[model samples]
Target: MQRVRLVDVARDAGVHPATASRALNPAVVGEVSQATVQRVRRSADKLGYVPNTLARGLRTSRSYVAALVIPDITNALFPPIVRGAEQVLTEAGFTLVLTDTNSATEVERSQIASLRAHGVDGFIVATASWHDPLLDELATEGFPTVLVNRRCATSALPFVGGDDQQGVRLCVEHLVGQGHRDIVHLAGPSNTSTGRERADAFRAAMRDHRLSVRQTVIECSAYTEQAGAAGAARLMARRRPFTAVVAANDLVALGAMDALGSAGVTCPRDYSITGFNDLAFMDKLTPALTTVRVPFTEMGAHAARRLLEWIADQPPTATQSMLPVELVVRGTTGAPPVD
Candidate 1:
């Protein structure tokens, strides 16, 4: 069977091959007229024509592929982010290559080097640490890279994510509004921006409400459930009389819940809890989790779009794109119980 080519489609559409190519290419779709674009698309659809991406890449000197590097693929929070970025890249006639580094810095650097060596056009990274030397190096080289959901403190890299400080403030305020004056915080690791920002925000919010920050705050080694449980246990061992717990993220909140249950405590009866990120299934928990919802999908999509702009030699107007957050009140929070 003879394979249909761009020339064949162009002939069927009564236009030159160049015009048809321009019409079909998403990167340059605006260069062609709408009527011509429609005609070429119809002809190509009728002939079941598929674009030769390899040939197009050779002509444009672009692989039209982007790499999205994440820290932990096993986490439930990343799937929505990946899907959102994938959708935007696909529509732009590009492919996404996903890599997970298990939160290892050296492995993440190696993955980026490998992807660059293989000629990937750009990158969207979500594994940046607070002081990432590798990311600084990439920025020094002026690479087309964007940070998503995480960012480096030293690099001038464009980032898209939720406002961690504002989100934590909302959580603290919510718990305080319920008369939880003595609230404990299970903070994530201090090495990452999300952890540090949220932890600092928790401290500031508590101080603003005239609460003791040092006595109620406990730092976790990582953002895992085990770390959360350990933090909670440590807080309890300190003999601090607190009526509420504010976890840095949903997974941490779940861990805190487990720790409290094992100690014969019940949520909203003995204590109330709040979580961040509002991950899936929070509403269906034994006692629905009250959390702050970050726009994960929007963050992913915006990061992809920003990378594309950079790749096209059109830098974004801002270096930081902070998406808004919302507080979701549910069954896990209530007024402090009578002592």
Candidate 2:
């Protein structure tokens, strides 16, 4: 089968190859008139024209590819982010390469090195530890990198994520409004920013509500369901007098539910629970989960766009872009059960 070429598109559009090239090129799409751009785009679509990314990369000294490094690809919270990023990158004529580091620092470093060796133009990392040395090194080396749904200790690099502190506050407030005064928190790992910030926020929010934080917070080793279950079990073993649990993420909340059920506790009947991330299928659960909804898709899209701006030698207007979050009420949260 004959591959469609730029010349054929230009011929069909009644324009020179150079004009069609400019019209089709994402980088210079603005240089051409909107009418001409529309015409050339229509012609290219009709001819099924696919740009030769390799050839274009060689000419521009760019791979036209970006790497999306995440902690765990299986986590449902990340798919929406990936979709959003892929959409923006695709529109910009760039391909997105996804890599999961399994929350390992060395693995993440090796993945970054491998992607760089393969000539990826930039990176959108969602696996940043609070004090990641690899990310610091990337910053030192002036790599075009954007952090999504996470941030480093230092504010040198650009990041896009939700307002973790505010999100936790909303969850706490909602539980409090439901008359849940004795609430426990299922915190995530302390190593990552999301874990640390959300945990800290939980404490602060609890304190702000004039509630005691002591003996009410249990940190999970990781964000996985296993960690959440263990945390919940530990909290239960302590015989803590709490009527609600605020999990750091949806996975943690699910784990908490598992633990509660095993202990013969019913959600919103014997106990109320709130989760973060508002991940997919939360509503479909036997008792719909009440969670904080982060703008995962927007965060991903913003990170991709920011990376593109950096790759184009344009500095971002802001160092950190924190999107807003909302508390999603569901069947899992209600007024505390009468003892």
Candidate 3:
């Protein structure tokens, strides 16, 4: 058997071998005419031609691969993001490698180092903290990295996320419109941008509605169910009187609901709760959740596109990309119960 080569495809497509090469290389395919690109691709397919990526990498000094670093693979919030990113990368003739650090900085550092040694072209990272030294370092070293679903406080790296302030404002307005006067907030970790921005936005919204902001924030240690449960427990222990709770994310909301139910408190009857992220199956909960809908899939796709632009030597026009959000009304929220 003989191996198919670029010359064979070029001969069959009636184009030069150089044109065939550009047509096959996604990074430079746009240099050729669309018709020629299609013709070359068809010829390659008919001849069972496969580009030698290893040889191309050696000549171009690029692996044509991007690494997506996330905090947790099992979190329902992340699968949509992964799917969106993979689709864009595959279309661009780039391989998408997914890795998780389990929310550990040390593990993240090690994984990133390993990927760098393997010649990954760029990174789409979703595990940034508000004050991440590693992210700062990456930016200082001129790495082509984009942050997804999270952002650093002062790092120069580009980032894409939902408009946290707008999302919180929508949640607050919805709860207030339903007559939730005394609302408590289950905030995420102060160390992450999502947590800080959402918590701050909640305060601003509450103040706008003439509600006292005192004792409204219960800071959760992480964005997990366990952290949500612990934060709810602490709020209960404080004996605060509130008719509604605004959770930072959907998982936190679920944990809070479980904790409240254990103490014989039911949603909308005794308390109203609103959550962020509007994750999958949120509408199918025992009492369907009212949450802020973030377009996570779009967010992921946008981040990957941004990274590709950087890899192509095109600097982004802006440092941040904030996606819009919507308030999803469900069964979990209602007018405050009679005192």
Candidate 4:
């Protein structure tokens, strides 16, 4: 079918094309009679006349293509964020072009170049390392890029991250409340902001609680299940009489759980544990993990919104967006075994 034009609706409604156009759009058409608005809508529905987003975008010099770049989509934490961003972008008359770097630096650079070459209006980036040279390179181009869950040290780039301090505070406080004193902190790779922030938060919370948490911090290779299991095993053998574990992320915590199971140690009876990001299936495990739930969806959507500001040639409202986090109390943490 040929593209439905406003003229068709105007001819059908016996009104001028401009009047029909004004009657159809909510902004200018509110002054038109409600009956006319309803009629235009009815005609539009009957004709299956969906507005052409590309034509409008081209006229405005806004291609309406938004880039959503992630480190790895295979991780359970990303699907919800993508779904939420797509919902908001669709309502705003924008298109999303997703790219995955698969955690490779060269691939990520190539992806960025491709997105920039394609004339994407802005970017919502969910991947950041402490020493990300690619982001610094992108920063010079004046493209609107919002970082999510990770950030560069410089204040120039905008970012959206979880309230990691609060999340770790809750986990530490919960462990303290459960009468644990010796806890192991499973630190993630320090190159990422999430890892560093959560690790720092755990230490601060522990000290603030006045708990003598004899901590043995082991840095994991990556936020992978195998790394977590290996780190947990090392901590178990290396630490002396530790009663609880606090992992930087949920993936690490699950790995720790597996290591503990292999050793035939019962969770909460022999030791309690905590994790972050509260991924799906956390509760279904033999002992449901107590974890922090970050607002990844809200952060993703906010990044999209901030990127729009860049596309509009306006400065982002804030350099960083810190979404709130909540602690989910589950089966993993409990009182230490009595003396």
| Winning model by TM-score | 1
**Cα lDDT listed for each candidate:** 0.91, 0.91, 0.92, 0.81
Structural similarity to truth (TM-score) of each candidate? 0.98, 0.97, 0.97, 0.90
Which parts of model 2 have CA positions greater than 4 angstroms off? none
Q: Write the per-residue lDDT of candidate 1 for residues 200-307, one digit (tens) a residue.
A: 999999999998887777889877889888988898899889899999899999998999899998897999999998898899998999999989998899999999
On lDDT, the leading prediction is 3
User: Residue 300 of model 1: what lDDT?
Assistant: 92
Give Cα distance to truth, residue 265, candidate 1, Å: 1.2
The ten-residue window of minimal lDDT in model 2 covers 313-322
> Tens-digit lDDT track for model 4 on 71-139?
888888888778777877775668899899887888988998888887888888878888887787768
What is the overall TM-score of model 3 with all chains considered together?
A: 0.97
Residue 26 CA displacement from its true place in model 3, Å: 1.9
lDDT of 3 by residue, 1-339 (tens): 999998999999999999999999888888999999999999999999989888888988889899999999978889999989999999888889999999999999999999999999999999999999999988988889999999988889999999999999998898899988989899999999999999999999999999999999999998888888898899889998989999999999999999988988888899999899988989999789999999999998999999999988887744899999999999999999986
Error of 1 at 35 (Å): 2.1
